[model samples]
Target: MDRINYQHLYYFWMVAKQGSVTAACEILHLAQPTVSGQLAVFEQAVGAKLLRREGRKLVLTDTGRAVFHYAEEIFALGREMAHMLKGRTTERGVRLNIGVSDAMPKLIAYRLMAPVLKMSEPAQIHCVEDKTERLLTEIGLHSIDMMLSDVPATPAAGTRIFNHFLGESVVAVFAAPTLAARYRDDFPRCLNGAPFLLPTTNTALRRSLDQWFDSQQISPVIQAEVEDSALLKTFGAAGAGLFFSPYAVSSEIQRQYGTQMMGLAEGVFERFYAITAQRRLKHPLVAAILENAQQGLFDLLDKPAAAD
Candidate 1:
C-alpha cells in the first residue's frame, strides 16, 4: 500500500472544514505557507486538486469533495483507533459513538447518556439522532458502536442486548387544542374525515401503528405523511393534524407547546429495544452504556403515569 502521511490528510480535512488556507492556518496555528504546501502535497498524493479559488473564496472542487468524504471517515476511524490504544486495559474510559432514534426524544435514550458523562474517566461521546432504519444501517456499517430504538425480533446484524418495555404508555391520537375541541370527546369516535399524522412507511413504529389502525378498521384522514418521527412530533406540536405517538416520547414537546394528548378508542404502545454487535457488547464502554440505559428505563417505568 502507498504510504500517506496522516498529517497531510489532517491538513486537508482542516482546509475543507475551514474553507480557506488562511482560516485553516488560524485554526491549526501553522504558517499559511506551510498549510498551503501540505495541502498541495496531499492533493498531489491523491491525484486530485481538492480545492480551488473562487473569487477570493476557497471552494472544494468535485474531486476535493469526494476526497474529503473519504478523508473524514479515515480521520474519524483514526481518532477511534487512538482512543482504543490509549484506553486502559481495565476500561477506565472510552469514546463511544452512539446512534439513537429521534422518535422518543425525551425518553430513556436521551436520559441514559447521563451515566456515561458521570464516569470518572475522560470519556468522549458522540450521539447521532436518526430514525430506526438509518440508525440500524449505521450500526451495520460499523459507523456507530450501538443504537437505541424501537426493536422487534431483530434489526440489521445486531444482537438484542436489552429486551424490555420502555413503559406501558398509550399512543395518543391528538391535535391542537382547537381541533380536539372540535371533536369534543367524539374524536376518532368516528373516522369523520379528521386529518391524521401518519408515519412514513417501512419504519418499525409505522408498521406497528398501521397494524393497529388496520385492526380497528379505521382509515384516518391523513392530512400529511412524514418520514421522520421527530418531524412528525414537530408537526403534531404545531397542530398541523392529529398524529399517533407514544405519549412518553412526545412528552417534552407536548410540555413545551401545550399540546394535548387525547384518548383514542384504543391505545397503541411501542416496544423499544437496544441493539449492538455481539462482539462489541463485550467492550467495557458498550457495557457501561447498556447498563445506564437499562437502569434509566427501569426508573422511567417506575414513575407514576402522567395525565393525558
Candidate 2:
C-alpha cells in the first residue's frame, strides 16, 4: 500500500490496547465514532481487517496481532524518546528477543539463556516459544533476535538464516519412583510393553527414540504423545508413563519432578542449535550464550554415565 498513516495506526493501537473503541476514546479524549472511523481507515490502508467484534469485546485477528506487535515496539521507542527529551534516565537494558522452539526442553532453553542474565549489564529478555517452522518465519520477519531449536535450519529456509550448533545430549529415560523401580531393573528390555509418555512424532527426539526402540526390538505401550516438553515431563512425573529427556537436565528433572532415571537411550541423542539471521554473531547476549554453551554447558553434560 501507500505510506502508512501513523496517526491511524496510533488510533488502532490505542483501541487494541484498551480492548474497545469506547475505552480508547476515553484515553484519546475523542468520540467513539472518530476512533472507530480511524480504525476502519487504518484497516483499509493496511488491506486487512485488524480487529473483529466478539460479543462486545474486540479481538485481534492474526494480521492484527502482527501489526500490534510492531506497534507496541514503535510506541515503546517513542516513550523512551520522550523520556530522553525530558532529561529522564531510562533503565532499560539491551533488549534480546529470542524465539525458542517448543521441542527444545524448557530446562535446556533456560540453561542456554542463564548466562545472559548473569551479565554485569542489565538485559531485557523476551522469549517466544513456538514450532521450529514458525520461529523460522519470525526470524525472516526480523521479529526475533535469535531462535533456539532442536534441529538446524535447512537450506530451503533461505541463505539469510544461519544455524549455530550449540551441542547435543544423550537422551535418557525417566519415570516416577514406582515406575522406575519396575523398569529400571531390566533396562531396555524392561521398557518393552511398559507404558511410555512420548513426545509427538514431529519432534526429532521422538524420531530418534522410535529408531532406537526399533533397533533394540523394544515395544513400549504408548501412553500419550505430548507436544510440550514440560507437560511431557509432568505426565511422566505423575506416573503416567516413562519418558525420555536430554541427559543434560536429568538431575534437574529428578529434583523438580521427583522422578528416577530408568536408563540411557543408548545412541539416541537430542541436539540443540541456535538459529540466527546474522552470519557472524554480533549481539553480545547471543554471543555470550553461544560461548557459554560451547565452552561448558554441553561439554559438562556430555558424560554418558553422569546420570547413573
Candidate 3:
C-alpha cells in the first residue's frame, strides 16, 4: 500500500537472474547484506513472498516467478531507452522483420537474405511467409518492415508502398531421381504429359506458366495444384511430380531437396520484388539486401530488379 521503489525492484531482478545474493551483489557492486535487504523490502512493498532457498540454490516462489517475468521486460525496456537516448542500439540483437510471399521459393528467399547474416552486424530476422496480398497488408500496417514477393504490388495495393524489383530468374524445373532421368534429355518435349506439380492459379508464376504452356502447346499432366512453394518442392523431391523454382537457386534446390534438375523453364520468368512503405528505401537491413541483390546474388539467373 506504498509507492514501489525501483532500486529495490532492480536489486530483486538482479538477484533473481543471478540466483544468489552474493553474485547479484558482485554485479551490482553492493554488499551482500545490502542486496538481500533490498530484495526483502521489494517483496514487502509488493505484498508478496518472492524468494526461497532450496538446498544450496535460491529459487523464486510461484508469485515471484511471475513478477520476475514482468521485471525482466521492465529492465530490458529501460536499457533500450537508455541505448536509444545515447544513439546506440541495445546489446540485444537488432531485429529485421521480413515478410515473404508463399509464391516465392524458400531457397530463393534464403539466398537473398544470406548477405544480411554475413554482415558485421547481422540482424535477427523474423521471416514470415504468406500470400502477397496478406504480406502487403502487413507492410502497410507497419507490422512487417519489408516484403519479398514474386509479384510486384499493383497500383491498387496502395500509393504509400513502393516496389523495388530485386531481380528475375527463369523457372527451373526439378524432379526426383525417378523422373529426372526420364526427362533429362528431351526437356521441353518430355515436359509434355510429364507429371507436373503446378502452383495455384492465384500466383503470378502460375499465370505466367499458363501463358507459356499455351504458347508452347505443351500440356503437362497436372498432378497437384499446390499453394505452398516449399511443399511443392517436398512433393517434387518425394517423386510425386516435377516442381519449378527460380533458376538462380537451381543448385540449392537440388542440394537441399536431394532432387535433380530437369532443366530450365526457358520462357517462364520468376521475378522478385521488395515491397516497402517507404518510396525512398532507408532501413539499413533493407539497403543491404537490395545492394547485395544488385551486386550479384542473382547474376547467373537474369536481369536486376531495377531494370524492370
Candidate 4:
C-alpha cells in the first residue's frame, strides 16, 4: 500500500488488544459492523489474514503476532507523545526490551541485567529468551532493543545487526560431590571414559567442547545430551553425569545445584556478545550492560580444586 490508513490500523490494533471485534467496538464506541468491516479492509490491504477464530476466541496468526508487536511499540510511543503534549511526564521509567538466546546461561544473563535493576532511575525491564535466529528477527523488526547471545551475529545472518563483544569465559566441568570424587584424580585425563552430560550439538559451546575433547585425546562416556543449560546442570546435580558451564558462573552453579567443580577445560571458552541494530550503542541501560561486562564480569579466576 502506498500509504497506511492510520484509522484502520488503530481499529485493528484495538480489536487485537481486546481479543474480539465486539469488545473493541464497545471501547471504540462504534457499531460491531463498522469495526468488523474495517478489520476486513485492513487485512486485505496487508495482504494477509491477521487473526483467526479458535472456537469462540480470536487467535493471532504468526504474521499477526509480528504485527501486534510493532503495533504495541507504535501505540506506546503515541501515548508518550500525547503525554508530552499535555505537559505530563510518563510515570513509568525507561523501558528496556531484551532478548536472550536460549543457549545463554541463566546466571550470566541475570548478571548482565542486574545493573539495570539498581539504576538510580527506576526502569522497566522485559526479557524474552529464545533461539538466536528468532531473536535476530525480532531485532530486525525493532521489537527488541538488544539481544544477548553466546555467539555473535554474522554478516551471513542477512540482518543489519551489529555485534558488540562483551567478553569470554573459560569452560569448567562440574559434577555432584559423589561424581566429582570419582573423576577428581588426574584432572583432564581422569575425565576419560567418565560419564558426561553435554549440551546438544547445535550450540557454539558444544562445538568448542567437542574440539577440546579431541585435542586432549579424552573420550567421555556420553550419558545424556541436553538442550537447556539449567536442566543439564540439574542432571549433573543429581549425580547423573558431569557437565560443563562457563567458569564465570561456576561458583553459583556449585552453590545452587549442590555440585562441585570437576576441572577447568583449559582451552575451551564461551564467548558472549551484545547484538543491536545500530553500530553505536544509544540505549543507556544497554550501554551500562556492555560496560559492566567488559570491566570485570568475565574475568578469569584462580582455579579451584576439583572436589571440595
- lDDT by residue (145-264, candidate 1, tens digit) is 777766642533455433333334556665678866776565555545667888777565677777777787767778788866667767877878877766554555457656776664
- Give each model's whole-structure lDDT: 0.68, 0.89, 0.83, 0.87
**CA RMSD per model (angstroms):** 6.8, 3.2, 10.0, 3.7
lDDT of the structure predicted as candidate 3: 0.83
Query: Each model's TM-score, in the order given?
Result: 0.63, 0.85, 0.69, 0.84
lDDT of each residue in 184-257, candidate 4, tens digit only: 99999999999999999999999999999999999989999997787898898999999999888878998999
Error of 1 at 212 (Å): 2.2
Q: Model 3, clash count?
A: 1
> Which regions of candidate 2 deviate over 4 angstroms?
1-5, 40-67, 84-89, 156-159, 278-281, 304-308
What's the distance in Å from true for residue 245, model 4?
Answer: 0.5
Best by lDDT: 2
- Candidate scoring better on lDDT of 2 and 4: 2
Any residue pairs clashing in model 3, and if so which?
Answer: 165-305
lDDT of 2 at 116: 88
**Candidate 1 regions off by >4 Å?**
1-94, 102-108, 118-123, 131-134, 152-169, 184-192, 249-251, 264-267, 282-285, 296-299, 306-308
Model 3's C-alpha root-mean-square deviation from the true structure amounts to 10.0
| Superior candidate under TM-score, 1 versus 2 | 2
- Candidate 3 per-residue lDDT over residues 155-188, each given as its tens digit: 8999899988888888878899989998787667
Residues 1-308 of candidate 2 have per-residue lDDT tens digits of 76979899899999999899999999999988888888898899899999999999999887887788788788888998999999998866777899989889999999999998888998889999999998897777667889999999999998899989999998889999999898877778888899999999998889998999999999989999998999999999999999999889888999999999877899998999999987436988889999998897887865655345
